[model samples]
Target: MSKDLRESEAASLDNEVLSLLGRHVSVRKFRPDPVSEEQLEAIIQAAQMASTSSNVQAYSVIAVTDPALKSELAALAGNQAYVAECPVFLVWCADLYRLREAAKPHLGGAATYEDSAENFIIATVDTALAAQNAAVAAESLGLGIVYIGGLRNKIAEVAERLGLPELVYPLFGMCLGYPDQSPALRPRLPLPAVLHRDRYDAGETVRQVKAYDATMSEYLRKRTGGAKDTPWSAIMADRLAEPIRLHMKDFLQGKGFLRR
Candidate 1:
């Protein structure tokens, strides 16, 4: 194991949180068990405790457990069967509607809640932070999770399905359940490539990326039992070559966000 893969450094730091975070992995396959309502509520409470911008708390979590809903959601999220198979699926939303309604009385028509880019960014940040907290809490309680960015692939249909109003956007979805498989841990880029003392360092990035690509290629081969090809650089290049949700910008515009 590389130094980054070892938990000994985390033990030296003497922080359970650090260790837990260090071992984080995206769990896909799950056991046939359900997470109880009580446990789900606890996870929501943990999510609510995450820091919000100016205490606005511009986020909402929609818990979907109905088999029918999960089935539709799974299909919508590119046929990821694990989504429907998981005990519960959560759609995290960036909710400016609550803030807009709340400001109606105070601003008295002065609040163009739909106009500012800052408010949009704030809601986005808040939703992501809250969802991450829920993920951490779920992991602590022995529940596995995988974030579904594919929710954005059909953003309009997703919003309509979830009954989201203007100023409320579905950011992403998460599937939670007990793990059924223990897959090899994916290696991350080296720390030096990310952390800098004072200013940004560009000189060492290319070398670091090359080395990390090689590491990831080996990890991929091992994890897939030689069934997968090892080409991190090509994978990334292919993904980046395609338009990531080509309609996202226009969709956000229709939702009245990112307007200066």
Candidate 2:
């Protein structure tokens, strides 16, 4: 293709991708309709295509459709009603169990690094990447999704409920179904705040964040009808001050991860 043609095609592709990504919003309220099996299959296929560390693909996804199981999982996720109401609750796991099994015969009882921090990071990153791809695919298919990090509130219970063996743990859950409510798109920090060039620029980042605080304050004011207008920085400060998910380290260790 000619240079101009190639640039035009690239821009066209960008627009298509950005159109879906830019309008992203978490859909908490879902309709009663169920997501079809075909759609679920396609979404998972897209998820599997995500990049993995050394092509190890150290991730597994569990689709919870049974009402009883979903109800129990919903309770485990801190009573997140959407977990039960949504047609499908997908539990994304950082799985080293499969890798361990596959390597066992080859290694002949050799010492393994699966319990090392590096492998843990790899598995977590791989799981996140795959889940994001699945999320985008579901959006494209007109299905709504909301990530349920609350699943970690009782992470051990969740793992036991899901029958996860050693070297595997539930990283997060996703609720998927048709939308019942259309929430406003939340604004994000300016690109300059996150995108650094060759080196980190702390001053530029601080400046951008201050500007974002004002933007978020206004957005919150409107969203809450003047009931609340807390600045983003203050909200984040409160978050940092709180002891959130303090058991994650212990839980991961118990699951035979991050030993080194």
TM-scores, one per candidate: 0.92, 0.95
lDDT (Cα atoms) of all candidates against the true structure: 0.89, 0.94
lDDT of 2: 0.94
Q: Name the candidate that leads on TM-score.
A: 2
lDDT of 2 by residue, 1-260 (tens): 35465567674756556788988899999999989999999999999999999999999999999999999999989998999999999999999999999988899778889889999999999999999999999999999999999999999989998999999999999999999999999999999999999999999999999899999999999999999999999999999999989999999999899999
TM-score for model 1?
Answer: 0.92
What does each candidate score in C-alpha RMSD?
Answer: 4.7, 2.8
Per-residue CA lDDT of model 1 for 116-169, tens digit only, reads: 889889999999999999999999889989999999988999999999998999
